[model samples]
Target: MYAHAKEVAEGMLGEANVKIASQNMGGEDFAFYAQKAAGAMFWIGVGNQTTMERVRPLHSPHFVMDESALPIGAAFHASVAIEYLNKNQWCAA
Candidate 1:
């Protein structure tokens, strides 16, 4: 991930909640965007500790989403966008 993008995310999400994942060879479509422009690919954790046993990895046939996390994810996206624009002196309008 771009350093600026990562910094923005950590600032919005809190450093404690931001984890630097080990580099992996997994193929992702976001690579295309990254090659063309500044971009980031981040994961929002949605597993509830109480029901973690029932959680399944993404793309699994039994995968289940924790709907409660929707609002949090939405807010994070908005925060990142607003912060990025502000830092760049660009209006979000």
Candidate 2:
């Protein structure tokens, strides 16, 4: 699952563009969903690399996301869904 997601993401974005972040100690609320089903979460980079500044850390004041990655994220998401459906025959016709 991780490999498929990573490949789809890298294909839509780029090799260097898609990064696997280091593991974090903090847990996400999404963990609840994983208890019921197999799943993986992706984090898209939305930082302002141009400014190289941090207005505030995540879950803090003034945290914002760059909308520039929307198309890339959407493409990756579609690719993942299509690939999974094809592989699993979830909507085979």
Candidate 3:
């Protein structure tokens, strides 16, 4: 995961036209993809509910989140993106 993240960071950021935002110093989840797509937004996810509820979380013993939550999160991200673009005249740019 770290290697993949580093690869993305290097590939995307080495470009002069691509200005990188908050790297957040690690501890990121797969959620980073959604966040980065939304201008490096950062978020915390609990766990994958679709996965075996009987099984443990990615790291912790007690953490958990529903896969259903992902859609809601995506919606939130879209709304935020719209709001930001509207505020900054991004579309006009």
Q: What is the C-alpha lDDT of each candidate?
A: 0.77, 0.78, 0.50
The predictions' CA RMSDs to the true structure, in order, are 2.9, 2.5, 13.1
Cα lDDT of model 2 by residue, 1-93, tens digit: 778888887777779888788898887888898789767899766677677566456787788867786777787888999987778775437
Clashing pairs in 3: 47-65
lDDT of 2: 0.78
The estimated TM-scores of all candidates read 0.79, 0.78, 0.37
Q: 39, model 2: CA deviation in Å?
A: 0.8
Off by over 4 Å in 1: 90-93
Rank by lDDT (best first): 2, 1, 3
Candidate No. with top lDDT: 2
Q: Which 10 consecutive residues of model 1 have the lowest summed lDDT?
A: 1-10
What is the RMSD, in Å, between candidate 3 and the native fold over all Cα?
13.1
For candidate 3, lDDT tens digit of each residue in 1-93?
333333343453344533334655756575767666634433434355457565454566765556765775575456555655565574434
